[model samples]
Target: MRILEVEHLSAWYPSGRTRRQVLEDVSFTLDRGQVLGLVGESGCGKTTLARAILGLHRACAGVVRHAFPRPQMVFQDPYGSLNPAHTLLWTLEEPLRAIGTGRKERRDRAMELLDRVGLGPEYAGRYPQELSGGQRQRAAIAAAVIARPALVVADEPVSALDVTVQRQILDLLAELKRDDSLSYLFISHDLNVVYQICDRILVMDKGRIVEENDTDTLFAAPKHPFTKKLLEAAE
Candidate 1:
């Protein structure tokens, strides 16, 4: 099933005396349970594409259609994304509470979510500052999935962690994808990381997608010059 479809989508930002286009005629589709990687250098409109898809940015033209309910986002900074003052349980319960879940059910669901993310009930009582980087990220992931969102937009989800921690978080995400049958719009500047987790890759340059292909095909033989440059840089 097609979870998301974007056709001729465009976005622009106002600059000095003129409106500068940040996304131009961008388009793509994401299927249920598929992992689509959006790869590009900084300021290449990668995040703009994500924001537009999530309705965080206003589009200039075209359409973004999705079969799912509102999608969730996992930001780059784990610590910053979470509330510093709230307990982990409280953080996880916010979504459930928003949907009118009862107090007893919310507590039970929060504990279940913690278990699913490989954390224990004890950690739920701790603050964001009390946990390690990996633990905090795990909590963030748990929060993102607690509501069982159909699609998740993870923008550089593991970019701030150490190499070992990065692997752990990536593994956790992959496991969650399988367990939940979730579709992900995984955004990153690192081709290598994307190659490891993404089924397909989209290469963005300036403000457009220069190339896109299955992960194996793109890695073995990149067609576009910009794609080749990204591959070379990754190497």
Candidate 2:
């Protein structure tokens, strides 16, 4: 079943004298438990598409329909996205408070999520700056999932990390998908990483989906020139 559908999506940036169209006529449907990798070069509207899916940016013209609850994001920069002043507990609590989940429930849920992400209860009191890159990334993931979101928008989730940490986080994401049946819209420029986790791939260029196919098929028989260029770049 299709969990999310984006139809004829478009977005414009207001900075230019004539509003520049950053995304144009983007469309795709994602199935439940499926990971769709949005891959392209920089300035190709990859991040813009992610923001639109998460409702952070309004689409110029199109419909983004989700069959399930709203999606959550595991941002690229764990420390930057997280508050430096707040403890991990408080960082997790803000979302719960926003959604009106009770204090006690949020506290219990936060701790449990931390544990699930491979962090101990002791780390709850620590600040974001105190943790390593991987730990901080895991904390960010835990925070995103604490509310039990059905979909996750992971934007360059492991891009800044070392190869080892990236693999660990990718494994964690795979595990979460299996355990919770979560759907993912993972945005990244890295083809190798996309192949590692995504079931299907969507190739975006100039703010549009140029080609899409099952991960293996796309790698083995890419039809689009842009897709071929991307594969060549990866080599």
Candidate 3:
């Protein structure tokens, strides 16, 4: 099933006194269990496109249709994404709590997610400031998938982590995708990183998706100059 469908989406941001377009007529569909990568350089509207889909950025025009409930986002900076003052338990439980879930159920769900992301229940009481970068990203992932969201918009999820930690986080995301049938709109500038988790890829340049193809095909034979350049840079 198609979990997400974006059509004719165009978004802009304030620049000087005028608005500058960030995404232009961007359209794509993400299947229920597919990991769709959005790849491009910085300032290429990747994040803006994500925000458009989530209805977070309003200075835009387009249609973002999705069936996923409470779509989640795992931002690039895990440290900033999470609240420093809140305990991990509180962070994990926030989603369930928002839905009026019973207290016991929320706690159970939170603990289960903590373990699922490879962060043991022991870390639940700790504040975000107390966890390592990798630990914090794990917690961020846990919170993102805590409610079993059908579509997760992960924007540069592992860009700030070390190589080993990036690999671990990628593995964890892959495992979660398998376990929950999760669909990810994975965004990043690093083609190598996107290659790890994305089943398909969309190449964006200058507020437009210049090319779209399956991961294997895109990597093996990129048609667009921009896409080819991106692959070359990653090499």
Model 3: per-residue Cα lDDT at residue 178: 93
| lDDT score, candidate 3, position 191 | 90
**Candidate that would win on TM-score:** 3
Runs of candidate 3 exceeding 4 Å displacement: none
- Please write out the lDDT profile of model 2 over residues 175-208, one tens digit for every residue: 8888888999999999999999999999999999
Off by over 4 Å in 2: none
Question: Against the true structure, candidate 2 has what lDDT?
Answer: 0.91
Query: TM-score for every candidate vs. truth?
Result: 0.96, 0.95, 0.98
Per-residue lDDT for 189 in model 2? 95
Shift of residue 117 alpha carbon in model 2, Å: 0.8
Better of 1 and 3 by TM-score: 3
- Tens-digit lDDT string for candidate 1 (1-235): 9999999999999898899999999999999999999999999998889888999997477899989887999999887988999999999999888888899999998998898888988998899999888899999999998888999999999999999999989999999999999999999998878988999999999999999899999999999999999989988
